[model samples]
Target: MRHATQLARISSILSATLPPELAGHVWFAGCDGPSAVILTDSPNWVVLIRFQQAQLLEALSHILEVPTCTQIIVRVVPEGLPNGYLTQR
Candidate 1:
């Protein structure tokens, strides 16, 4: 499992690498707990990504090799540790 910090890095990379059209149309939004919402001006293209976590990762990997994200959600673990650690444990 990857840490939120690492995920943040991944998100950043993903955000930056998005195609110009996609970049302008898409904006990553609020971190509501473990899930964060992605806002889009072009709903059509974004529809492919809106609720698919796997798609998000796929898009990120294809677009940005190492980009900084605009926003991210860091889910907290019940044991007062980061969720990443909890998952690993």
Candidate 2:
């Protein structure tokens, strides 16, 4: 529950950092070591997120107050699935 709250907080911060055009389409997934996982509904958004990788990392590091936030991993998850569906599978 704590981790989920933290992820949600991070998601809110990162969502605000995104371009207005891309805001709702991208979301925080989870963190793997120094990498921040991100999820999007489309492949096109993956490329767009990559374009903002550096900025995203910067924002993440600032929020977490850790320079170790070094990588952003973006994955495509189809929209409208129930939460936790991916993990269940």
lDDT of each: 0.44, 0.78
Report the C-alpha lDDT of model 1 over 1-89, residue by residue, as the tens digit.
Answer: 33455554544555565654554333444345445555443436554444344545456545544323333332322234324422322
Candidate 2: residue 10 Cα off by (Å): 0.7
Model 2 clashing residue pairs (backbone): none
Find the 10 residues in a row with the least total lDDT in model 2.
80-89
Q: What is the lDDT of candidate 2?
A: 0.78
Over 4 Å off in model 2, which ranges?
79-89
Q: Could you tell me how far off, in angstroms, the CA of residue 14 lies in candidate 1 after the best superposition? A: 4.6
Best by TM-score: 2
